[model samples]
Target: MYISILCFGIFSCQDLNLEPKGMLGGPELFGNEYGVKKYFAAIYNALPIEDFLYYGTNSNNAYRPDNYWEAGKNSLGNMSGEFFNTWVQVDNDGFAYWPYDRIRDINVFIQSFPEYQVNYTAEVYNNLLGEAHFLRAFFYFGLAKRYGGVPIIKEAQDPLAPVETLEVPRNSEYDTWKFIYEDLTFAMENMSTDIDETGRANKYVAAALLSRTMLYAGSIAKYSQYLGFQGEAATSAGMAGIDASKADEFFQYCVDAGKVVETGPYALYTRGYPDKAKNFADLFLDAESSESIFIKSYDITAPGNNRLRHSYDALMCPQPDMSSFVGAESYPPLDFMELYDMPAIVNPDGTPVRFDHRGDIRNGMEPRARGTMYFDGDVLRGKAFDIQRGIYKNFDVLASDADQGSPNAPINNPNNRILGGRGWTTEINGTTLNITGAHGNFEDQGGENNGWGSAFIRKYVDPDRATSDVREYRSDQHWVVFRLGEIYLNTAEALYELGSRDEAFNYIEKIRERAGATITRPALDQSTSNIGTINKANYPYSIEKSLQFIRDERARELYGENHWWWDLRRWRTADQVLNQFRHRVLSSYYVADEGKYIYLDEINRINRSWTASKQCYYEPIPWGEIGKNRNLLPQNPLY
Candidate 1:
């Protein structure tokens, strides 16, 4: 059932009637294992909503860098406005009440479990208990990540209880993480390694979460080692609490967790359908692959249809007469793509090998270059492109705007100015091309210029689902949280940090092998293309260089599946990546008297607004939360 959005604000009023009062305590459910299982399923269902993979990037909404707060782009009403303000206290409508709700359900389930004495067995009892602990840890982890410290609500709340008495003091971030780790440890020890369903949290799933948690703690501690805690410091939250020593420990934890799966039943989902495409790409797009440790299963017969696919089509579908595909919101900034060094000669190998020259790597992989997207008429997976808008007006709102605003005359009635049309200018085979779409010269019905960012992101769009309205298919696609490949990268990164270049390379090479890509080995011969013949100036040689290299590899390998943003933030490259690309494109667009692009020079001259804002790294804490719980919540400096 579609859970009511009302669940989000259930905590706002003490006398709220929305509480699930009798559901757990009712005689119908209090005495049955079926009731407990169904209740547990509901908790699992709640997970995909806002807790994990909420698509938190507001930039994906209205083609702007930050669209989540815009009243027009979202349905969250005034809460959308709070998105930009750090003082707002709105919790995630889908998630804020989860762990608390689930914890209560679990408590009731455990207490009433004795009623099913006839069916009680050691295996059944152990599984339920294990699931409870794992879920508890999962909920706590979410709290720790969002708020530094949160109350560990272990039991159901009384409906008649006073709100003031119920309110608990905040826990330290350190304590919260420590608690989550310990809880997960218990979960791992008690829970069986197996789960028949796709969505339920399993041992491996818990391990994945631990890897991420450890990574976050380690990275934050490492980065924050030198800086004294204060107001906002970096452009992203990943940069705020970085301590190098902490980072080391986090990486170690991540690697350690990975080892469990490395040598166990869990292996990389490498075996693809021999009937279909035998490529690794097949493994990712195809749902049946064995490598998928956990997935959010969506059945068309029951709560089916992929929301991701639908979102993709809705946002990117092309406008009439535009020739291209659709709205390109969340365009991959140029700076991020530059991280992948372009190979000298294009190799179809899925793996991204090392580049001879770092500078050349930047040049080869520009989104404007054919190497980035179109490789001789086929949509190459490795390359990226500007958002495509169709030529027809019926398909997109932004396209109509562009048609009316045209100087050619007979300006048509533009529907919604911000809705569609026009594309960004990108390079194709080294030649600059204007990939116009809704954002370019589009005039809205209000006669105002309508459009957002110039670049469009094509990563999430399912090529198979492309249609008139881009949102043709709501793909209930399974998002990969952890995989064998990530484990390898984690190990390699941690090893590199530990000053084990040789060992790290071994791990890095394993990843390359899995991707079926070219591997660059240390030069053993003077073959000009070989490592031996290459000039030392052209290649990276140090441990630090290897760390950076592997990280970049991860970027290209996992571009659209939702990992790069976090990686960029962790590497302290968000501003560097985002701003650099913005400048690069702007500069490329504006040409001067001598035919030289002057956009870069102009942007730098106007106001280094983007650059300066890098100091506002982590997203500001919701102001509303702070107002309600002043004792617990703290702002993340300079909203």
Candidate 2:
């Protein structure tokens, strides 16, 4: 250790003695600009941004299985219904944050800022102060979303205070939201719009968060009655419900926030893009995209943190061709797959298209579905990923066994499916061909992959880079936090909720247009091609139908992007949508005799089911925290 000569008071040693506090150098060190910057670094390190580094309570570790889910690969996709994990799990709605020390830093920053020795301009002071407020509000909003209401600690609590004195009671849910609102309003007011720092929170970022969080609060308030809000504290202290009159107020907050953000340089991500699919696919990869409102930049230059960008690719990319680092832990479920518009049998009129041919069902679907998911025949890097369940061998017994819900090993056998580097060779008509579309092999450890029939998960894969030589573990693309497309959807949803139905529909149409979706079926690449277009019908004007459309639209628009889990919860439809779902069949087979493909074999596909209850909607507060603070008594209902 080196010692530095310091004159606490140059005028006199008496001046140093005049200081009432015991420490002289300590205060001066932190009161300077560089000292503040060092403190800020520590604060930044603890912010609950929850982008890539976030890990849920018990998710599987992708790169390091001996460790917990640090990289959190495919966690968002698996938790939401958009994709399935290779290993089946009873999912938990996680709120993996309890950052009190960070908040303490924010409190100190807010209070002790004026005492700093350095001469900071008013703008610098405001920006620093405003950022603190924004972080505090963002952090608190996350708490409110998970716990309904949490203790509001505005001022720094006295460290020396007795435990009894520190045990503050929990605030009501409405109060918690209002607390967040107050902090955010302050932040938006004081923060500068001039700064263009990537990954740094600014006035626009605060507004965007306010827009989203306020919408959540307003909706929870308005729909609590509809969504089953009946709890002891709900009526007592507004813990779980807000007054119905406040719905419009909060909705206006979201609307106003959106308006503020929309006026900026932000816009949708679909201009100069020749096709809709490419336009949609490239949205997340493009770092300079005006669509991104708040971004967490990940470049090859980010020191020692290559894990941030690479975790997602390692978890979501297809297993067959992808590097060994990948887990292949995500694939769209059959029900989720069916939500896309079919390519075949165009809904020329505004009506639902019925499934007449099972084999050809996946074709002719919505263009957005193509942009969102990887289906059975999705090609990547010039590989077709030929995903057929079984070849037509004229042997009915094994096929029947597949229907009878037999163990997957037999179906994975060479006699049944192509196995052990072998293709099923058979003579058909006058020619001999080896049909090699079968792809599956479950992992015994069930860590890396669980051959769930190659539907190959494909949402955030980079199109610009050739995935052929890609696994450096640096996913290297920015994860979008907010975007103008989402804002448009939020505006539509808010307008509808606030009784502006026509306006709502118009906003929805903007998104549909950007997506290349239309009132009727979308046109195909070629007339003869059976591949799908946006197969669904046009919006009907009824509010009920419009609401349903919104539900489907959200699922389609935000699939695998980590938004569905919250959507289902906020809509109060978690119990209904997530309660019991069936994976009845693994992969569908084709029937050539009828000159049609039979995709579903309902007779043999015994139910493979999943269930989540209302309780799964809210996360449980840590038992340790509750035990430590008796004031947090009567733990969140149903805990």
Candidate 3:
């Protein structure tokens, strides 16, 4: 039967128009399980989680007509100063997201759901109803975080409603959070404990989001008042600020939500393949693993959905076959590397890792760090990463000047820049000795990129997906939206804020044990928690000191994963952390000679304005929305 299926899809507006032949209206559509499933699928497709297929902003629609190479990694990492991307935009479009039309779609689904004449089982109907409520809350949470105190629109409004009637004012920040919490609370109460699909949300998913969102609210309530500029917009409508009085109340909510997930089945990935490095690397690769509480699974085998594949394999993967054959740039910096503590040389009692001599960068370090990043002679799976960016004249000889001696000293051999395009740097007698095929550089004749940092990123790359024949294949490794490890961290952070300092250290130990720390969870307590080998340096018993280590641990654990930028922002330390990244110093260890270490100094990476404006907390509401409706003003405080 040739039938037109008029179903709900991810669009900028709400449309309820269906074609005539075997047409399914609300009663017919929601009454059947098959129709209901297809409708919500479109809603799920519109989620703003930056997954495998999400290629963000490209160039200003000019010379590079279809370049979708910007958002996915470079901007995220560069802003955090973990890795330096070749693509740099200083004052770029800062967090431009205003999906009110999509918000309306979610509202329409929720409002119309109860009225549908459903013949399906009550269980099926309720699950869909729970999902609608959860999705609506999730969408609002996204809006509130970016643009604070957004209008609380619950029921679907008429398209032809009067402009004045539609002009709802922005709610208070506290009230907005309460609104999100109430909806999520309803979802937790009503949603199914289990979902058949891998990517579908359950009670655990709601709890994870609830835990994260409450933590954000707690931070805003406690820390924001000290830094934000107070004005008429801030006072008139609760635009950019939160009520400081509700700090502990929201914190308790965070703690309770995290505890709910803690009692759930999720846990840090312990049993796996090889060593600590391989275990950490494969955690992201294994889609079936229990560590992932919520995932956004991608399917390359979907016939027409092949266009959903991304160029992440091309951009983030440093090797030739891995990079989908283009944009093989970006490298990790030294300031980032220091965050990883050495279990070997550094004692549990805040002692420095003993160096054999001067400039031994790799002697004592976390296996997780080596797992996340490339070091000299580092091998991943079966492939060895030969990061020989710093060349030596002889086997016995190390370069006297590894640093850029002069601004005009020239970056090693500029001819070697074009990968295999320029062959053999030096010659003895008549024969040429070619040191070719560098790990970080990939060249297709004219197009070549050399690694800016000393090492290549090794976290998310699935060795199996680096197909020699199919360079365009987007890796289907499921991104962990909320994992057990992060929940543990969330629990610890919330507890720490609530004055349970001893209990906070207790929870952090589990994450340390998973990272192969010298000190295990059993060994750590308030008495023996002096174990600094897993931490940066000297785990002082103070809450402030412990908080710093938690931040360091988050960066080490989630380096390429990158929730650290938002974490820092929540903690009110963006200016403090990001300002330090203005100058990045990377160290290179020769693969041929492990002892011969070289420094690539003076790499300034960060681009942030240090002015302490609380408006930085919330993204600017798009002017288009304000021009149409008068109530979205004073337009997010400073915007």
Candidate 4:
């Protein structure tokens, strides 16, 4: 059965006979290689690739929607406790992302492309068919990750068909992932090894997809039972969790797929030599980076296409100095900053360590942390970042005396602490001093356009754009979807889970070597525990200490790349990890008597906390879909 394709006419024609040039019919679209390329472009645009322009409001704005300049404010980083921001919190219920329309478009191509096989050679025909299979698998992956078991719709159904015939039931969770595996396997077997045009999938790209998706599947298989939903309807029916016995099979699949990707012509990016920090920072801005497995390009040249440009720079850097627009919206939290090897901000005696200059905090910090964030005195666009919080008069007590910057602390008296808004000044002993830094910690102002923490997000931010040109919708930096750095991390985790501990750290060392970490290769510890050191989350099931290290490494390497939320969900630890999690900020202060600077840990001004419920592991299927097709009933586990 086939659904009729509609083509609307713009002009009314009574007697005039004319051949329409505006739209192409089925044969004209699928008959030639060029025509098929044009057809595939639309499908590529509708993919579930979450890039810089993704707005997390609802399904309509999920897939790179146009004019979504507010993404930086409400980014996945802010919502998942990766960064501190005032705009969005953890939304337990997802935006109901069902993309059957896009799936139907691909299904039409798969069903109809064979009719034009005579127009092309056998190799070209087979490659195109394999590309279609890869596309279908991508849509299924998006569904399986959100709702555990969605209906498997391979063929396009007719709209006029009987209701009973069209209402397909949901497949089991294991079967849904198996279907994705089959499609990706077909893609790997038939797709060409040669690179396709930029932004298109090749055999290597398909393998990268397989590597990531199967890792998620392997995680679900191993950790779903720990969520304690064993007797629920979805769990009992095998719709929400996979059997624990299948964990090794899925992990092996992930490891094998990663090995295939390594065979391709790709390597970790190392363009800016000698300065490992600069090299790491340049990876995201370099368009021809060798580390990039697949990337989605954005352009500012197109006049009216809002999706072609983003506002990352404008929302990340401060106003009047770095950006001409709204200014910084998200700042790095101290919790994440401590994940890296930072300098000693406090002495062994529990007193705050005073630095000759505030920028001296970067002296012994990890180079990767330096590359990921901008500290005081880090210059960009001809202006140095001055991120001091306030000034402390006379000798200071232990850091605990400040009580995390609480207002009720005795040391926080107005006479002892000098806090002010942006550009504010105060007179002291015949001289005037600026209260807050030029960029942040404005006590009188809110979080909007103010740097709430001591550091700013530098990942994926364009450094070369002139301040005058840094307006909303004027910056165009490509968002990398799959890079070699991430592939290495995926392989390392999968290998460790399969009990190959030594081989896992081999991959971890390579990543740390590029970032110039202090301990490039630490001795492996196989001791098992369920207590997470980062958030102190108590997991229901125990894992090896080396495995937890691999997980933390993923957070450090993939910071601000929009992977934290999904990582927490896939591990079945979101509820425990984010239980009333309050992001902390590092505040810098100038000592009036000692003429030095001190950095102390403090809670954010607003005291915002993010919490995720147990049900956040799996989103409920869209209620509207169940209304139309009752077969979609057993709506996810909790909702």
TM-score leader: 4
lDDT of 4 at 342: 79
Q: What is the C-alpha lDDT of each candidate?
A: 0.43, 0.60, 0.60, 0.85
lDDT per residue as tens, model 4, 159-266: 679989899988999999989999999999888888647789999899999999989999999999898888788888788989988888888988999999999999
Position 468, candidate 1: lDDT: 41
lDDT of 1 by residue, 197-246 (tens): 66777777777666666665555555433233444433133223533445
RMSD of 3: 6.4
What's the lDDT for residue 329 in model 4? Answer: 90
User: What does candidate 2's lDDT look like per residue over 388-492, in tens digits?
Assistant: 454433333333444433446454344544222224545546655434353332322243544354366666776445555445455677778878888777777
**How close to the true structure is residue 500 of candidate 3, measured as C-alpha lDDT?**
84
Give residue 630's lDDT in candidate 3 (0 to 100).
77
lDDT of 3 at 496: 76
- When 2 and 4 are scored with TM-score, the better candidate is 4
Candidate of highest lDDT = 4
The predicted structure with the larger TM-score, 1 or 3, is 3
What would the TM-score be for candidate 1 when compared with the true structure?
0.63
Model 1 is weakest, by summed lDDT over 10 consecutive residues, at 597-606
* Deviating ranges (above 4 Å) for candidate 4: 1-22
- Evaluated at residue 196, the lDDT of candidate 3 is 54
The list of candidate 2 runs beyond 4 A from truth reads: 1-38, 57-74, 88-96, 226-235, 301-309, 344-363, 393-454, 464-472, 519-543, 583-588, 592-598, 601-608
